[model samples]
Target chain A: MGARRETILETIQQYVDLVATGSSADVVALYADGATVEDPVGSEVRTTREQIAEFYGALDGLEQSARLLHTRIAGNEAAFAFELVTKAGEQTYTLAPIDVMTFDDDGRILSMRAFWSGEDMLVS
Target chain B: MGARRETILETIQQYVDLVATGSSADVVALYADGATVEDPVGSEVRTTREQIAEFYGALDGLEQSARLLHTRIAGNEAAFAFELVTKAGEQTYTLAPIDVMTFDDDGRILSMRAFWSGEDMLVS
Candidate 1:
């Protein structure tokens, strides 16, 4: 909770950017040592660093672009809506996920829970 | 987590609607008897029905309009961003609060945590 507002916001942006243009390690680096990730909410949580990195490994290489639609930073927790577009050959799939993250005093993410499902995806 | 996606979404809409135009009791009715509300995340958690109603009492009689910008329902939980505009005399104040709620089988909200702070408010 000691993190400044700008610090938290910057981390969120960095997270989105890294997922779009960087390696899985880049995204995993944003989390604290004991962080957990539950992308899509109901999935099994990724607790260890190796597991967390593996979870993001799906985005290691792809034609994707991301942007933050809206964000709310409160205390050490943040909830944000973001858009991600993945291009595969002739089809383009878009999904907007609302991610909730709790951060530590050091500004590293403590836990991340994303609110999204296949029903929310749109392909064009 | 027994609630359907549609039911959860409907309850969220009803909540926003009641806050904008109905009485505090009307809004409190959407919650389960044991529901808890932690507005702005860092504030005190309101647990009892009377306490929760008291927290929302500030909006009992105000000229306000509310709308949901975007929402995501996963499992029995939903997270969304919405805007509330209050008009007093010639002044207008607006706030976009991102709310995360967990619903029961009957679609009654069990816990609602709002992710917003005073820094997110604006006046014009």
Candidate 2:
């Protein structure tokens, strides 16, 4: 891979790692000031930095772990498929989603859209 | 890769190949009867088979080609990133989109959602 692509992948991996480790602050720091996030593909978009931070912060309570399954990089965009396992209360849930994220020249995330549905999740 | 993952990838690759070769009918054949398609992430969803066929039919005119960049499969879902090059009139355009597709047990496509925007395209 080229250096630029390597950098983009590293940024995405860092985001995934932070999320897995429950570092909400660091996750929010990876985005650009006016970056937008739309989780679950069809939901309302979160535009402001504060809103984006809030979205990430919501994951704080859940015992979550993520495994990167695939990564594709082209230009300043990277799309990854990951499996997320979360333990909430006495239940454990698994979700597999494909998140397409675009980065700015400075490597900050510009937009994040996750494609997944209720049908994509499993509970145990 | 497991046998099931291999099958899913083959199905996705065949769909891409049909699109690249301008075989709209064959592309439509890959989907189930009530499949849906939402191109460009957020658009009017095409639900009926006729509408889905018509959507693929629209791609027949342009000299189009696609290259699969990445593929990920988990359960009955697969998401892939690909580069689409199209020659329209005297101009050539390139679009890179990540499309998340879900399939039924019979290997027929259930839904296709493409994640891309004007910012993700290039023209020459």
Clashes of each: 0, 0
Model 2, span B1-124: residue lDDT tens: 2236567778899988788785789999999888999885547899998888888888886788888976656567777878789998889999877788888777888898886666667899
TM-score, candidate 2, chain B alone: 0.92
lDDT (Cα, tens digit) per residue for candidate 1, span B7-111? 888999999998999899899999998999999898889999989989889898899999999999889888999999999999999999899999889999999
DockQ of 1: 0.89
Please tell me which predicted candidate would have the highest DockQ against the true structure.
Answer: 1
> What TM value does model 2 have?
0.58
Q: Which pairs of residues collide in model 2?
A: none
Candidate 1 residues lying further than 4 Å off, grouped into runs, are none
Q: What overall lDDT goes with each candidate model?
A: 0.92, 0.80
| Candidate 2 lDDT (Cα, 0 to 1) | 0.80
State the lDDT of candidate 2 residue by residue for A1-124, as single tens digits: 2236667878888888888885788999888888999886657899988888889888876788888976656567667878889998889999878888888887889999886666667899
Per-candidate TM equals: 0.98, 0.58
Q: What tens digits encode model 1's per-residue C-alpha lDDT throughout A11-44?
A: 9999988888889988999999999999888889
